[model samples]
Target: MSRGTSEAFFDVVEWAAEQPWSSGKVGLLGISYYAGSQWRVAARKPRGLSAIVPWEGMSDYYRDRCRHGGILSNSFIKFWWDRQVITNQYGRPGRAARNWGPDTVEGDLSEEELAKNRQDQNIDNAANHFRDDPYYASKEYDMADIEVPLLSVGNWGGILLHLRGNVEGFVNAGSEFKYLRMITGRHDLPFYYSEEVEVQRSFLDAFLKGDDRVGWSVKGKVPPVDLVLRKGDVGFNDAQAEKAYPRRTENEWPIARTKWTNFYLTPDKKLTRLEPLHTPPKKLSYRALGTLEDPSLIQFTTAPFEEETEITGNVVAHLNVSVSADATGPTPSDIDLFVTLRHISPEGKEVFYTGTAGDPVPLTKGWLRVSLRKTNPDHPKHRPYLPWREYLSTDRLPVIPGEVYGVDVEVWPTQVVVEKGGKLVFEVASGDTQGSGIFLHNSPEDRSEEKLRGQNHIVFGPKFSNYVTLPVIPPKYGA
Candidate 1:
């Protein structure tokens, strides 16, 4: 809720260190909530807090969990709260399964009671505070004050909420002794994955026990950012699929010698490094509530690579766009863009990976609303890879009816080794597309659904030309 709530954790850390049997050393561990708490509490710069390994936790509550680029991120939050939160209440059915070792039990609740006992998700309370409000900023972990060593665990699938924060924490944190580990696939994999677990163990060992081996360097437990990046075709091995264990170690973070490639958007729905010379189509339009198959969707694809190309870290789209009045929702004030990154095989087929819901999925995703394009000017421009994101505002600026707006759509980070002959596809739409699942809002991003009136466009050409900046990691550096 507030930074005030962050105080309890430090209180616990201090109490633990004061205990006679305690070693006067403390470290925070756990996945998701447990991991997220580490960032919040550590920001306080607690006395006994020794180290933290925040595994797949969303550090920024507003930007990550509540909304994405000013639109409501519906399903995940509701499902997470209703299915996971409500189901584990003190007296709800299946509650015992979450209890401690010996006290766990099996119990069934009557329909009437189960229904009555369940609590409302109260999700509106979060949505109502849109933007960098006091409530959310309070919950935000102060990266500047976190001086202790930390091992920021990350996931490609965690881009929806966890991935950005994990990487941001590592990059912005005040700690001099910090490292990052990014695995390819599943979100929960980092928790118990052997390789991931080992990374965690060694990190914890160096801090907690002052003794350890493996990837760990004895000097304050620091290790380079180890990414088990996804390889083309074969992808990650089967055992490492869910957790994304690499066949071999790859390059470090802030990838040295990054080759920034701009795949320019074209009117023909294809992308190429070469900028178009002729007066190509100026714009492409799509219904704000269009289906995944909407022909108006603007798509760009590059030719299959002739050699391995590794793409890691933030993938952003630099675009010039505009919106129409009464688009998709009740009013004409907003326009939503859901951009997806997909893989295509050389043999005229699309590539797919298992999703978090155990279904086939693709690489990563990004989103943005035109009016919310106000960039965080303070965000370092040198880091072209990371997106400059601020927050949604209820009284935010409105999109001009026909004016082309230059904006950067921050695609979530993706880690993959594209095999020779595998093509990269980028799609932009008013709403969700084929590969944009898991992160799906269930509800459309535009709120003016009543009249269903609006059309948005992605413009390209000499004047409105746009392109996506990819973080191309050189071939053999991490292979």
Candidate 2:
């Protein structure tokens, strides 16, 4: 039934055996499907598979790809499996099998038809195992057993599946030589085909090829972690490409420089820097757009700034929220929140950073679906906002109307230096706002204008309240 998996494993093993090596050091390289497969072979502890470059690959199938906080990440998985796995014939030119629509069970289909069939099968499987079922668990690999060095790549816009997994794997993996590199952009967009591939190649060369030219040293002895901000068009050429990549050597995950500040959302649509407005606990409810699927998110902005501010760290939002019974369902509501930094020019045109200063700047950006609002008790310091720990025990708590529950959303780690007079903004909404297109409601079958409705309440007071903690790099005096 799973001949593909067995065949793929042996193919790599065969290739490894042919490699000329005084020391058994072979690295696995590829994106998505190839990267995903490496995990399976790596788990077996292949003799020569010393390092792995799992670009945009996930360790946990359930949390990362299969189910997004219990809801199926249907759109992403269905499309990927069809394009990359099912119909991928692998060096063959034959058409894929089609089984998606009502008519075909013949198993023999055209490439296009097979693609559609594969998509259908993927979605059907996802829908059937909608709950955190065994099928989902079966696909997941045990992270504790992975013993090789890993170089995980993550994207800021891949909120649906890839982003969280990269972060989680990089942090949780027991590998002593694990490194994380986060780049901003869409998930499927070319990382290998683009100049950014140099960064990846350097890592592979150093770890796998034993090349001392592409050393991981950067003035210090620390974990080689980088958070690359995709500015825009002005990227590094072949010569300076590898050197230009962002590198931040750190002793731990979610770098220590970050400061977590809780910004409270008010009923009047005002984002205040203060704590809870009152001690009695207040709740503000808005009319849920009822199509609870993709509710309108909230955007918070600071008054236009006059100086260049470098915000480089993890961001989390603490919301004391609730849902109107008339609006949503018994199942917990899932939505996405985004944090953006924009430079409002004197002409009032907002210039978003797409890359670095010398590189093209991004127009606008966001992170997504951070369901865990509670902080990990082991490393809870309201000072640096690092929401790395997952609180799996509190999954059943439902949001009640007029009731205040703390909901914290973690924004991916980023490094952006907003110039003088630019505005530092945070937009919290229910859906993806990066690309403008047809809006996708959560569930297509159970289409209901009423079931989608709900309201979010925010509480801000002195002691128990709302604020945003920022990592302020103190000025270098007398430099």
TM-score of each: 0.86, 0.70
lDDT of 1: 0.70
Query: What do the candidate models score in CA lDDT, each in turn?
Result: 0.70, 0.51
List model 2 lDDT by residue over 268-377, tens digit each.
44554564345554544434442224446555556555565556555555555455454234433533333443334534565533232123333333333334444565
Model 1 error, position 272 (Å): 0.2
- Give me the candidate number with maximum TM-score: 1
In candidate 2, where is summed lDDT lowest over 10 consecutive residues?
230-239
Off by over 4 Å in 1: 1-5, 91-94, 97-122, 214-223, 235-252, 291-296, 325-331, 380-382, 392-395, 444-446, 450-452, 476-479
Candidate 1 lDDT by residue in tens digits, 1-479: 34656788889898998999998889888887788788888888878788899988877776667678766676677767776656565445544455622222545667677667653534453445455565555566567788888888877666577877788788778886788877655565547757567777777777777765653545533345777656645443244444433644434566766677888888887888888777565788877765545533667899878887878767889888776765234545556777888888777677666455434566878887666777776766335666566564653666766777888888877777777888899988776666545555546423445423477878766677688998887655463
lDDT score for residue 87 of model 1: 58
